[model samples]
Target: MFGILVSAFNVALGFVLRTVVVKFILFFGLYFVVQAFVPVLASLLPKSVDIAGLFSSLPDSVWFFVNMFMVTEGIKLMFSALLTRFIIRRIPLIG
Candidate 1:
C-alpha cells in the first residue's frame, strides 16, 4: 500500500514535493519537542499528577520510543533548515 502511494507521488510531483516534505518534517520536530518535554514542564498539571507512575504501568520502552522518534525529528528539522536556506539563497537580487 505504501509503496504504491510513493510510486504515484514520484510520478506526479517530479520531486517538487521536497520543500513541502521538509516543512512537514520541521513541523513534526516541533511536535516531538512538545511531546517529549511535556511531563517535565507539567507545573500546570494537577497536584495529583504522577508522570512516572502514569507511564510506568505501560510498556517499559515508552521513553525509548519517544527518544527514537524525537531523534528522527531532530534530523528532519536539520534537513528542513538546510533546504530553507538553500531556497532563500536563490531569490533574485533587488538592489
Candidate 2:
C-alpha cells in the first residue's frame, strides 16, 4: 500500500509539473518579451502632437458624439473580453 501510494504521488507530481509549471513559464516568458518591446512601440507615437490641445479645440457637439461612441465601444469590448476570460478559466483543462 505504501509503494502504491508513492507511485501514484509521483505520477500526479509529474502531471502537475508538466502542465501547470510549463504553462506558467511560457506565459511569463511571452509576457516579458512583450513588455520589453512596449517602450520601442511607444516611441513610435508622435511626440510633437499636442493631444490635449487637439481635443480641447474640437467643437462641443462633435466632442460629445465622439466621447459617447468611444465610451460605448470601449465598455462593450472590455466586458466581452473579461467575460470570455472568466468563462475560459472556469473550464477544466482549457484554461
The most accurate candidate by TM-score is 2
* lDDT (tens digit, per residue) of candidate 1 on 1-95: 99999999887686557777777777677667656555564565468757557556766477688676785577669967875564445433311
Model 1: lDDT to the true structure: 0.64
Score each candidate by Cα lDDT.
0.64, 0.75
Off by over 4 Å in 2: 59-95
Prediction 2 TM-score vs. true: 0.54
Which 10 consecutive residues of model 1 have the lowest summed lDDT?
Answer: 86-95
Instruction: Give candidate 1 regions above 4 Å deviation.
Output: 1-15, 43-95
How big is the positional error of residue 84 in model 2, measured in Å on the Cα after superposition? 16
Query: Which residue pairs show collisions in model 1?
Result: none
TM-score of every model?
0.29, 0.54
Residue-wise lDDT of candidate 2 within 1-95, one digit each (tens)?
99999999999999999999999987777667656665775587568967568668889899798797895577679967885575456444556
